[model samples]
Target: MDNSLRALGDRLRQLRARHGLTQEEFAQIAGIGYKFYQDIEGGRKKEIWLSTVERLAAAYGLRAWQLLMPNMPEGSKVARKVASSRVHRR
Candidate 1:
């Protein structure tokens, strides 16, 4: 992992744009604070909670790793493991 929250946030914003969801709408669906998402998008946070990631995954119809590694295609090892881990609630 690059551990670059800003890059991850940028990817998130890009993905949200691709899905045509506004920040408010995506935050509502993802169970996150609009400002928090904005902060994340703004690169203000270096660490993001797992709960937020899980919420985002569920709401975005993706596994945690899909969002975590959003540029990769679906079913990649990271996404698969993330999905599998989520299935087991690990």
Candidate 2:
């Protein structure tokens, strides 16, 4: 896999974990097939379309560019809310 793709996969895994979601749950929320998402997150996929990126970002209530950033953007309001809710649930 390309290094960039691996980096993106790592970020995706981290974000999904932070939101307290399983791969299946995140795939369902992103409206993508479980196997396809698994491939993406596992860095086994050869290519990723812009639309897929958009869909994944939408599921996180973020923009595609934000998702692609080298660092996790601090602009995710939804992430903050979800994180706080997870804390409360615990």
Candidate 3:
């Protein structure tokens, strides 16, 4: 698996635990299939779709970029770059 995907899985697992939710519960909340959610958390799914990212973010009450780049602070260089690119696309 890619290192980035592994990190994302780790972060997602941490978030799920922090929220006191089981994988099944998290999957249900995210409106994703339980087995697919497990694959993501286990880093078996390397390439996540943008819609899935959005879903995960909504499930955690976070922005899509937050899930894409875990631990990135708001107003940081990377965040600004992503935001600007998103704006340019619109």
Best by lDDT: 2
Best by TM-score: 2
> Please, what are the lDDT tens digits per residue for candidate 3 over residues 11-65?
7787877768888777777777778889989999868777777677667767778
Higher-scoring candidate on TM-score, 2 or 3: 2
Off by over 4 Å in 3: 70-90
Question: Ten residues in a row with the worst lDDT in model 2?
Answer: 81-90
TM-score of 2: 0.80
What does candidate 1 score on TM? 0.69
Q: Write the per-residue lDDT of candidate 1 for residues 1-90, one digit (tens) a residue.
A: 345676677777777777787877776666566777787767877676787677666666667777777374353221211222232221
User: How well does candidate 2 match the true structure, expressed as C-alpha RMSD?
Assistant: 8.5
lDDT values, one for every candidate: 0.62, 0.74, 0.68
**Rank by lDDT (best first):** 2, 3, 1
Per-model TM-score, in order, reads 0.69, 0.80, 0.74
Rank candidates, TM-score, best first.
Answer: 2, 3, 1
